[model samples]
Target: MANALCDTRHISYAGCVAQTFLFVFLMSAEYSVLTIMSYDRYVAICKPLHYGTLMDSRACATMAAAAWASGVLNALLHTANTFSLPFCQGNAVDQFFCEIPQILKLSCSNSYLREVGLIFCSVLVLFGCFVFIVVSYVQIFRAVLKMPSEQGRHKAFSTCLPHLAVVSLFVTTGFFANLRPPSISSPSLDLVVSFLYSVVPPTFNPIIYSMRNQELRDAVRKMMSWPHFSRHKLLFCLYI
Candidate 1:
């Protein structure tokens, strides 16, 4: 944003490193949180009786801490490994952000194989988390299907579907952005894919969740009507 406003594309070495670390950390943490949310939904829908006991405040706090810790560890490993490489190629990055793949493009050494290996391992971990989410949702759906009441099923679907939509959007876009074939890669395509995974999910998440909340919707409606109501009251007072 600062660069765009200033009409300059230059980023300092330290700024690049910071951006890389922060981007990876936040993205990793978001995935972890999403995984945890799947578990939460599973417990709520599948084992309602034990939900409180299983997802207690302490347990939630512990999981949250672990997620942040994993993010930090991931960021440290990728940032350290990536910036350590010598860049003989030009510093220009194809993507809008300081991502690992874009940074790897700037490296001109065989040592980049190390970072590639690390990325593969990271992908495996992320895949495991995705599988966990899938399994949890399967269980949740099964339980929802077993419910006798139509309203109950509808409520369960309503709660779970938004989360599933968000997870699908996040995971699919990210996977495509990172794993797409090189033959079809271009600057514009990369930027668009990057925006989809990096920008769209976060931008939509709150809207998706808030839209499901009846109280929030009501509040928003009331807020929207307030100016009109105030104008009517002022006119009546002037006429009186």
Candidate 2:
């Protein structure tokens, strides 16, 4: 919109490249963290006895850091490969953002081959994490089934089901958006799928978690009530 606002339909090469890097980095980080969260849930549910030891504060922080680092690495690799290619098709980015797929479409050179390799590597990594999440859930389901109390099983399932739902939404939409055949690619379809995977999940994830997790629900309620509570406390102080 900056270009639109300024009546200048151009972005600096560096700015365009940076935006592309951020796009890849942020997506990679989100998926990596979600994968870690699935494992955290697995440890919490399938091995409650070892949860504290396995997912200590330090361990969680380390995992988070690793996720971020991996994202940066992936972004750097792809960004370098992508921009190294010549954009003979002109500077008019078809997508709203500097998306790799859209930008690659503008490349008149075969330099996109390197970027394709990076994309394949990224897909492999994502697939591996997807498999890990699936295995973790399978174990979690088995563990839940063996629980003696119905209420306990319900609680476990409730906590897990939302994460699985979100993951499925994210993965399926992303797969469709990114892996769609070029022969069938439509601008409207791309926009809708991109919005579904990239925009919708992040916006609705908190709602999903708050709805399903009692602890988070209570926390949100407390936060929402804080202003009223503060006003009441101030009134009580004045009355006293």
Candidate 3:
């Protein structure tokens, strides 16, 4: 309510615009991406034999498109609900970011309608993806457990380990924060939750999946050797 405290009367249209853009972008990028990972596991586990055929480049692209559209639409509803109310008396916004509840707190309007709508939208979109991810992994976990070969189980879990960890962290922190009372949400708790939601997943994803892959490591070594060979007298002469 910086604007209100300073006696400015309304929420800045520009600020709302910026916040809407960020909310939409983050929803589409991070949250929807989690669905793709979940669907991928479904393909790999539920239809392993057909995964190659079912998830060809075009099919994967289409799935990604669908997920992006869903996330975008969901965010639109939330953003519209958030800014739809008129704020006449006060203009103090809450949170470091445009988190839904924070915006809800700032408005003077009877917030029940928007709050209910926000809860409904959040449950449908975020919790929906979360449920699918959980079910997909439960099946995957079962399948991995049932594999006759230890190697199979190890391989399956290894591929899923990073995603499973990321999903758990995101969902758990978010769920607790949303479920808990406002009085319970402190800066330290929010900071840790934010890190789990945003930073940890991006940091671990590539390194977890790609770094230890033998094929990639071998390609790197091969490329390095090729440069050395090219620098040798005969190879250099041939290159010249």
Candidate 4:
């Protein structure tokens, strides 16, 4: 993007294609990771006895690898279908990024139908993951309710709340951006929704998790204090 700006918005054909492919790939991978993280939490809170075994390091790595593979396949499918369309409407994209919804606007023919098919398939997969997350959380909530101690229930809710919030933001913005009717697709709306789907969750997730998590907060504090502690130790050493 900085290069685009520096070159006065002269994005090369290859750059455009790469940007669109990466946009879909990274977004899909991120949402998948969030879904997996939710399931990990569900196991930790609702099935504590088996959590360690179920989400061992090997399992975590496998799940992460699957998410990346799925994201790449989905992005390749969309990218191929998208570029196959003749851009009779011209090369101009109204948005800052090269997403399917905006790129489809420039198609010269109705050849975008193939891309729509891919979009439908993608939506189905995303909705399935959403449903899975919802079901997992439902089970988690039920278990939290049955906890004998109020503090235990509170801790569980605290841990789950950030994940739920991030998921809702991610799914809602993505749905609006991809699923909006063409008649209602104004530049302003597209820009706003694109920002939400593309930028918000990536920036927000870590902040939400770190600020809400006690362990993460403590680790951050320790990290921040290390330099000061070292400085003090050096002064004490000189005095000694």
Candidate 5:
């Protein structure tokens, strides 16, 4: 972005804003998927007996709202720095996207406060929240494992495995990219890591959900075949 805008390959202000919004969308998508998966785990483990009652439509809607709320808050905070100040002096952004730190460097204004906000929010949401979720799932797995039946154990493992994988990969790469290593902070590295984070959620989410869910597949097949079966029955009734 910095290079492209500096050499007139692309514009910088809009580039930064676009990058921020993309991050917002990605985070929102991740949070939505993870929250629903968490609730699914919650039902499968914590409230096995009353899973239907607890995780009905309303509960799912609430979880989605919470996830979207976080995304909106994050976007608002990140974007505030972009349009808040006049950056006509030097508007070169040194990353593929409009990240707070990289954008702050080009600002002719003081960036101390923005830097602090970025640091705090990064740890609070990315690391802190993820750690909490990991700990919660650990307890959930322990509880699920205590069930005596083989069928129950298989089900529990299937439900929890995909979430654990996604969370671990997300945290590891995202954290590494944010650790502020001088070498890795270059525009090239930033672009590469940005792509990695951007591509991960969409690629892995469907695979995880589909592979882990056999019953959902069966149900779809049955629904599709039901119409055919009904037509056959009507023809037989007319003949009889």
Candidate 6:
């Protein structure tokens, strides 16, 4: 925002470092939370009898704490490793934000190899989480399909599908943004991919969740019928 207002592209070194740290920390935490949410849906649908016991308040808190802790650790490692490298490729980052891969492009030292190795390990961990989510959903769908009542199945799908959609959007865009081939990469393509992964999911998550809520949907529908209210106004409200 400041850059746009001032018509300038430069960011202070400290500002860039801080941005990188916060961005990684928040994204990592969000992904971890999403993984935990998949487990939540799995328990709710696959093991309804054990849901209360398994997903008790204490367990949820513990999982939440672990997610944040992992994010902090990940941010610390990546941020420290990324900034420690010598930069001879100039300070200009190709992407809008101070992304790790973009920062890596500016390195003039072999030590960046260590960060690359760390990223590979992180990707493996993320892949494991992705696999877990997929397996959980598989079990959930199997259980849902076995339900004797159509209403029960509908309810289960309603609760789970929004979450699955959010996860899919998050994972696919993120994977492509970070792992796409260098051969096809261009500044325009990179910018769009980065925006899709970083901005779109968070922007749409609340709206997606709200759309699943009967009460909220009804309220929005009613509001839309008001003479004073417009579609743009409702959209602004949703975005807020």
Q: Weakest 10 consecutive residues, lDDT, candidate 3?
A: 89-98
State each model's C-alpha RMSD to the native: 5.2, 6.8, 9.2, 6.7, 10.0, 3.7
As for lDDT, the candidate ahead, 1 or 3, is 1
RMSD of 3: 9.2
Q: After the best TM-score superposition of candidate 4, give how far the Cα of residue 187 lies from its true spot, in angstroms.
A: 1.7
Q: Assess candidate 1 and give its lDDT.
A: 0.93
Ordered by lDDT, highest first, the candidates read: 6, 1, 2, 4, 3, 5
RMSD of 2: 6.8
lDDT (10s digit) by residue, model 3, range 59-98: 8888788877766776677677767776664555544455
**Candidate 4, superposed: residue stretches over 4 Å from native:** 3-7, 180-183, 213-240
When sorted by TM-score, best at the front, the candidate numbers are 6, 1, 4, 2, 5, 3
State which candidate has the highest lDDT: 6
Summarize candidate 2's per-residue lDDT along 88-147 as a digit string, tens digits. 888888766678888998999987988888899889999999999999999999999999
Greater-TM-score candidate between 2 and 6: 6
Clash counts for all predictions:
0, 0, 3, 0, 1, 0
| Clashing pairs for predicted structure model 4, backbone only | none
Better of 1 and 6 by TM-score: 6
Per-residue alpha-carbon lDDT of model 6 for 119-231, expressed as tens digits?
99999999999999999999999999999999999999999988999999999999998888889899899999999999999999999888987899899899888866887
**lDDT score, candidate 3:** 0.71
Off by over 4 Å in 3: 1-12, 186-240
Pick by TM-score: 3 or 4, better one: 4
* Overall lDDT per candidate, in order of appearance: 0.93, 0.88, 0.71, 0.88, 0.70, 0.94
* Every model's TM-score: 0.91, 0.84, 0.72, 0.85, 0.73, 0.93
